[model samples]
Target: MALMITDECINCDVCEPECPNHAISMGEEYYQIEPSKCTECVGHFDEPQCAMLCPVACIPVNPAHVETRETLMQKYVRLTQTAA
Candidate 1:
């Protein structure tokens, strides 16, 4: 599943750089995760880098964008292909 940044985000600015997909960005109030670009690091890492590096643990799976691991891997492949 894609991940999301909650209101609990402290805006520490750590997660943004950690995201391999560049899905995290500064929102009007805090950091936000773009579901379209979020593959939860399925293609780049074993775990979500943003959530792993976030100090406040504000990143979590997006319930609205729930997806299986295989689906996430597919998204990751698509994203990488597009970038290439």
Candidate 2:
């Protein structure tokens, strides 16, 4: 599943740069995760970098964008291919 930044976020800015897929961004009030670009580090790291590094533990799985590991890997491949 993709991850989401909750309102509990302190906006400490630690999560943004750590996301390998560049899915996190500053929203109107806090950070937001773009579901389409979020693969939870499936192809890049064993854990989601943003979630793992968030000091406040505000990042959580996006229930609305639930997906399997294989699906996430497919998304990762597509993203990388597009970037290339």
Candidate 3:
């Protein structure tokens, strides 16, 4: 599943750089995760980097964009391929 940053985010500026996929960006209020670029860090790491590094622990699975591991892996593959 793609992860999302809740309003609880403190704008700590930590999560954005930790994301390998470059999916995290400054939103109107807080950092936002782009679901299209989010793979739960499947292709890059064993766990989500943003969630792991977030100081406030505000990142959470996006219930609106629930996806299986297979789907996330596919997304990772596609992203890598596109970047290449």
Residue 76, candidate 1: Cα error in Å is 0.6
Task: Evaluate all candidate structures by whole-model CA lDDT and list the values in order.
Answer: 0.93, 0.95, 0.94
Candidate 1 off by > 4 Å: none
> Relative to the unseen true structure, what is the C-alpha lDDT of residue 57 in candidate 3, on a scale of 0 to 100?
96
Residue-wise C-alpha lDDT for candidate 1, range 1-84, written one tens digit per residue: 889999999999999888899998999999999999999999899989998998889898999999999999999999999999
- Cα lDDT tens digits, model 2, 1-84, are 999999999999999899888999999999999999999999999999999899999898999999999999999999999999
The regions of model 3 sitting more than 4 angstroms off are none
lDDT of model 3 at position 41: 97
Q: Model 3 scores what on Cα lDDT?
A: 0.94
lDDT of 2 at 48: 93
Clashes of each: 0, 0, 0
Q: Residue 7 in model 1: shift from native, Å?
A: 0.4
- Put down candidate 3 lDDT per residue, 1-84, tens digits, no spaces: 999999999999999998889999999999999999999999899999899888889999999999999999999999999999
